[model samples]
Target: MQTHFNSEYPSVEHLRAKAKSRMPAFAYEYLASGCFTEVNLARNTSDIRQVQLQPWYLRDFDGADQTTELFGETYDAPFGVAPVGLQGLMWPNSCQYLAQAAVDHNLQFTLSTVSTASIEDIGQITNGRFWFQLYHPAEEELRDKLLDRAWEAGCRTLVMLADTPTFAYRPKEIRNGLSIPPRMTLRNICQMMMSPAWAMGQLAAGKPEFQTMKNYIPKGLNMKHLGLFMNKTFSGRLTENKIAAIREKWKGNLVVKGVVNPADAEIAVKHGLDGLIVSNHGGRQLDRGQSTIVPMYKLVPEFGGKLKIMIDGGMYSGADIASCLACGADFTFMGRTPMLGVCALGKYGGHHTFEMLKKQLQQVMEQVGCSKVSKLREHLIAESVPV
Candidate 1:
């Protein structure tokens, strides 16, 4: 697919700037900000940029290809859309829009448990080929029900969110009143009014809700109580017992996201998980944590063959994706880049972002004289500066 985005928004940073300009301040900050000082947030991308690739002029190579295989599935590209909660709040109907785009592009689209679209709806869009990310519910019955719903919808891969044992203290979110049962302050209202296009889109789409969890929420609960309900519904932390139970219940491929430690990766392997995504909740859950790329670099050599190793955090471009692959990541995922596209161009955002990333990755492969996605590691320069 060719990028429909013009030269003005040729890069992810460009799309992000446009997204910030087009979206309301509160919404943009919610999507953009990390917890507290946001040190890890900035480090995520900055550290990735530190990785340098060497071009080989002497090597002969055929046309570059970005096809990648993970968990028995072959994808057109090496990177996929990382699941993000409250996606519709960024752009109305964005979850479905992204799901459809992923299907059309033959890429993986993981749907969040807290996303605006329902499991069945996205299942229909992707023909049950999409991955489902689960936030462990407080109740076993609720967890079982959600799993059943996902399986019935034809979802085969389940990504269990392991980070976010506790919510991060985001000063921007607090000041903007973007928390649960969000406070609609006058400043926020004015910010929304300023972004007329975003306001109009929200009006047309109706209020964003947790479509997957709404069925379990008791009716007539006010926004404050609704917040309480959400808090009570998902416990955030996953224990060994909880993981054991899920392993027993879920017969399909199981993956644990938010793994930044080697010990945790070993635990997931012991638990028989099919894959592990080395992430730090996109730097939203922990402000002082190490950049995801650092841990990915350390853990890949230890557990690359033990299970399918993937990484997602701070990757905004195809070069970033290539860097992760060179460092030993089997696959890559990006959360905010695609949303920036959607927020910047409305319905055309997802496709344009995918195509742009594909083009950029293909260029990187050609420059390195690498022809296949799996061969990206061969282009890694040994003794390169540490990320």
Candidate 2:
């Protein structure tokens, strides 16, 4: 497939800067800021860069293939777009755009339950090939309803969120009144006024809502009630019983996200989960936790073959993906990187970012004398591994 990269924004930093400028202050802060002091957020990316891959300069090279096999299917690339809630608020139609792009790229796109787009909308876009990340609704009836919708729509891979037991105390969201429908404070309105592109797009696209849960929301409720309703409706904490129940109901691939340690990983394995995503909720939940890269040194050797070991969080560049693979991650995912792409370049932003990553990863593979993505661990630098 021909790539659609714009020479002007070759790297993630360039796309991020452009996105920041084009987006409103509240929206940008929502997308960029982490909880508390953001120690974990910064640590995630910083530690990923610390990992090094040794290059072989004089070996018979057979080029490189980026295709990855996962969950009984082969994907064009190993990495996919991780689920990000409020994606439409960051960039209008970004959720829909990304779903389309992931399909075009032969990659996975996980849709969050709180995302602006509904499950059916994405199902149509991906022809039921997309993955659905359940937020674990409070009621079994509600959860079963959601699972039924997803099944009818064609989602075979269900990602059960295991990290967010409660909403983190993000200072940015608190100050900005970042609810489902943003609080229209004078400051927020002014910020929106400053970015015409974002403002016009939001206006044209209509107000972003939790389209997946729209039917259950009470009618004639104000923003405060809506927020309260949302808080009461979905449960972020996933128990062993919850996992077992889902295991019984959903007859498809089940993955538990936000697992970083052995104890939590044990629960997934006990419940017969198909995979474990070593993530820190993009460092949005815990400020002092270890970077996603730090735990892989332990998780991989213990459960690598038992289940598909995937990862996400603090990944920014193709080299970051390479570092994760070298650290023994079977597959990878990215939240901020791909979202920044859609926010930076609009409709085709996903294409540009995915293409850039493929090219960048391909170059790394060829230069390191690694012929395939699965062989990336062979190039790992023993002394400088992620620890």
Candidate 3:
């Protein structure tokens, strides 16, 4: 698998720096900020980095392969693009670019419920293979309609977000007026003017909107009313009854995202959910919560074979993916890093970031003398590693 990435930006950090330079301050801050003090956000990456893998120096070895299997489908790599809302706001046409890249590279691309691209459009782009993340609308009818739309568009996996019981109080977003129904302040306009590339891209792609939710929203509503409509429309809290209703309605692979507790994992199993993405909303929803890796460490041992356990939050590179695998995650998803890639290089970012992560993961596998993605657990150095 040859990755045609730019040599100058080889690492995700490089991509992040470039993305920051390319995007407006408000957009970059919204993409980068976590809740409150961002303690958990930093911890998600730092704690996962604590996981150590022992390398095998002398062995009869073949080249490493990164193919992974999940939900009866095979992916070229163990990692895929995690869903992010308002993706086009960060980089115009990012949703389409990443979806096409995912299809071309044989990876999963999860489309957020509020993403700039519509469900049907992304489904067409991925040939019905992309996963759709649901925000859980307040009305049962609306929820059922959204599910039906996803199913009709050929989405087989529905990632039900359960972490955002309420939107996090992110200071950066609040200050920038980047919250729901984002305020178009003069300062924001000035900032957008500063980033011509991003501004021009937005001009070409048209204004970023909740394309998936637009049909349900009434026309001619002001931003204030729109915000109120969004607030009333999406009820993030998830109860067992709600899960059961979703299970009855959606006849697809239902994954409960934002699960951190072992008890919740049990509840998911009890409710007949297919998988659990042990996430803390990428550390955006909860500021003081435990790192995603911590819960993953506890959950995998308790329910490894009971249900599929995937993880996301602070995963930045191939080594990070390898770390999660060594810690017993079935598959991994990355959000900000891939978005940063696209923001930095526009059309090239999608394939470049995907290939970069794959290349890095292949290196880790070779270093650990593991050939298959599932065998990454064999390299875990459990004793000396600090969680």
TM-score for each prediction? 0.96, 0.97, 0.96
User: How far in Å is the alpha carbon of 9 misplaced in model 2?
Assistant: 0.2
lDDT tens digits, residues 157-267, model 1? 999999978767878877876643346788978888899998899889988888998888777555532234456778878888999999999999999999999889889
Candidate with top lDDT is 2
Which residue pairs collide, candidate 1? Answer: none
Global lDDT of each model? 0.87, 0.90, 0.87
- Scanning candidate 3 in windows of ten residues, the lowest lDDT window is 221-230
RMSD of each: 1.7, 1.4, 1.7
Best candidate according to TM-score? 2
- Candidate 3 lDDT, 83-187, residue by residue in tens: 998898888999999998888899999999888899999989998998999988989898988899999999999999889887677888778877433567899
Worst 10 residues of 2 by lDDT: 221-230
lDDT of prediction 1:
0.87
